[model samples]
Target: MVVDVVKRCFRVFKKANESTGKILGNMIKVQELRRLWGICHMDWVTGLPPGSDKSYNACLVIVDRFSKTQIFFPCCKDDTAMDTAPLIWNRVVSWTGIFTNLISERDPTFN
Candidate 1:
């Protein structure tokens, strides 16, 4: 019963997918990322209770794409892009050195 339902739904979806491709014509291809030390990814972990001594409720996580190494910096929830950029530059980059590319989740404030 489930298999039959799935096949029916898949047929409908496949027809729509084919028609959309015909209407859209060409599709875009994204360049693949190479395993290179030049690439790095960053993200924020938020919505946590304050820590022991300081009132840190969030963390800025930076990961090296090649090395798979991570550096986590504890931060307050109120830190803005201005504060983060400098902190990453002065502290994180100073230690880990610089990278060619930085991939982020495009967080509203992080932009």
Candidate 2:
């Protein structure tokens, strides 16, 4: 009885909230015609067992969004932005040059 009443009240409250909600605008999609070089996506893989090098337990993976080519850089778990930036510059950027767009999952390190 009480549980049923509470559920009914909750449903009414939810419906009221939904009715008052604002509609969001449609999202814009990227078109390939606007594609340019140096647009890439990056991600980090961590928590792997230490390798033969012992220090490098994580990998920084960068992918060219247009070409679908990937580059992997071995890095230590404690690598700072200062430490990792040069690796990207020397190993990845040296070949592809500076990137205009870099997409990645929200990560504190990238900030």
- How many times do residue backbones clash in model 2? 0
Q: What does candidate 2's lDDT look like per residue over 11-109, in tens digits?
A: 999988785558867864544523444578888899988989788899999988787888888887777778878898888878787788777766677
For model 1, name the residue pairs that clash.
none
> 1-111, model 1: which lDDT tens digit per residue?
999999999999998877444354465443455654467888889998899977899998888777788889999878899988998899776776676787787787765
- Cα distance off (Å), candidate 1, residue 57: 0.2
Clash pairs for candidate 2:
none
lDDT values, one for every candidate: 0.80, 0.79
Model 2 / residue 3 / CA error / Å: 27
Give the Cα error of residue 2 in candidate 1, in Å.
21
Worst 10 residues of 1 by lDDT: 22-31
Candidate 1, residue 72: how far the Cα is off, in Å: 0.5
Task: Tell me model 2's lDDT, rounded to 2 decimals.
Answer: 0.79
